[model samples]
Target: MITAENLTKRYGKTLAVDALSFSAPRGAITAFLGPNGAGKSTTMRMVMGLDRPSRGSALIDGKRVQDLPAVPRTVGAMLEMGNHQPRMSARAYLGWQAHSARLPRTRVSEVLELTGLASAARRQVGSFSLGMRQRLGIASALLGDPENLILDEPINGLDPQGVLWVRSLLTHLAAQGRTIFISSHLLAEVEAVADRIVVIGRGRLITECSMAELRERAGTRATIVSTPDAKKLVRVLREDGAQVESELSAQEVVRVFDRSASQVGEMAAEHSLRLHGLLQEKVTLEQAFMELTAGAVEFRDGGQEPSATAVPSAMSDGDPQ
Candidate 1:
């Protein structure tokens, strides 16, 4: 398992990561999430031992990353794409990493095929497209076939099919009892695969829980009622203490929050209202994430600039997508 105990980082007078604590257990996929300037990248770097923490610790299996014997064989991380030599072929690059880690060269060919880069294995890194580079990065991380994987934006440049392939690959790896910790802006995909979520904002821990727990805590369920008498229904629902909202473009549509479909239907029936359609709308991950991080956003369009103390200097909190 990957665990952080008050993991903090600071650059000069600016604090990049606060006292953040969380864990990504084995046999599960945990998604690390936050908005721009939320210090996600910095935190990941700290966990990998690439950046020293100002306080606290980042641990893998109860040991610090640097203290772990044969670190490459124990954990594999893909923090960014396109960090390889541009003149090297995909196969040659993986070979170099495998050689450095004392891993068998056969693993190079295995990961290339696993990441769907076997056909492009001989292509120079500079010639590879964005998606291909992403695949190569993942291949390099899997070169050691470590039991724990930490990937940052692994699906950034992938196409729809590529995204699906990644989803399947992560699922397959997790099923084998590997710990998969990834950070992605793709909320829908995260929702589909993540067993737990850790959300941070402004360099502090916001929330961390399982997918089901997040849905429950957010209470993201609403009922949609379509009727010709939307205006009257809205008034009645408001009088009955139901939070009602209407679609500006579709006057016939009304959304009632914190109420179930049956409850809304009964209310409509009691008021002798004609309902054209009634259905419950499940709150999506995107909606819940937005609600949970609404106040944590560091940058906003046409919003006031944050005070100097509120913004980090040396290391901007924004993840360079």
Candidate 2:
């Protein structure tokens, strides 16, 4: 297991990471999510021992990555792909790293095939497209086939096919009992692939929860009703302990927020109310995220709007595709 105990990182006066703590256990995909400049990259860098933390520390098993018996063979990571050499082929680069790590040299070819880079193995990494470079970087991370995979935005530059391939590969690795820790801005993508999520904002841990637990805890299953007698319906629903809001352009058509569609249906039937429309509406990931991170936001409570015509309501984390 990879665990962090009060992990904190400071750069001069700015604390890039606060006292955050979480774990990535074997046999699970733990998603790390945050906004831009939210200290996600900094935390990952600290975990990989690329930068020493000003306070606190991260460890794999019982030892820090810096104190591990073997460095690259214990943890494999793909942070950014811009550090590739200009003249080296993907195969050559990966093979060289694998050999240096004393891993089976044949594992290089395996990683190339696994990342779907076999066709581009002989191409110079510098001449490759952003998507190809991303794949090659992932290939290098998997060269040693380490027990842990810490990928930051692993799908940053990829075609639909490549994205699917990476998703499948990660899911498969997690099923094999390898710890898969990933950081991403795409909530819906992680919803499909990850078993647990560790959400942070402004350099602090917001919530660490399983997908099902988050859905149950944060997401509200609401019943949306549109009726001609909006005011009357709202009055009736409100009498039944359901939260009603304003959503009418004309006379009396109201939107009610109830815990369940069945509850609304039962109340409507009891009151003998004629409903024009009633349906269940799920609170999406972005909506839940907005609620989850409301307190963590810096300028939201302040009187500054990013724009005059910007969206008044928050955005939900869904339907990124």
Q: Tell me the tens digit of each residue's lDDT in model 2 across 139-171.
A: 888877788989988888788888898899999
Provide the global lDDT of candidate 1 against the true structure.
0.88
Once model 1 is optimally superposed onto the true structure by TM-score, how far is the C-alpha of residue 128 displaced, in angstroms? 0.3
Mark the 10 consecutive residues where model 1 has the least summed lDDT: 312-321
lDDT of 1 by residue, 1-321 (tens): 999999988777777788999999999999999987888998999899998899999999888889998888889999866588999999998899999999999999899999999999899999998999999989988888898999999988999999999999999999999999999988999999999999998789989999999877766477988898888889999999999899745648999997888988888899999999998887788998898888888767888886454544333237322
Candidate 2 error regions (>4 Å) = 225-241, 245-254, 268-279, 295-321
Candidate 2, residue 253: the lDDT equals: 52
TM-scores of the models, in the given order? 0.89, 0.82
Q: Over 4 Å off in model 1, which ranges?
A: 227-251, 266-276, 313-321
Q: For model 1, how big is the CA root-mean-square deviation?
A: 2.8
Judging by TM-score against the true structure, name the best candidate: 1
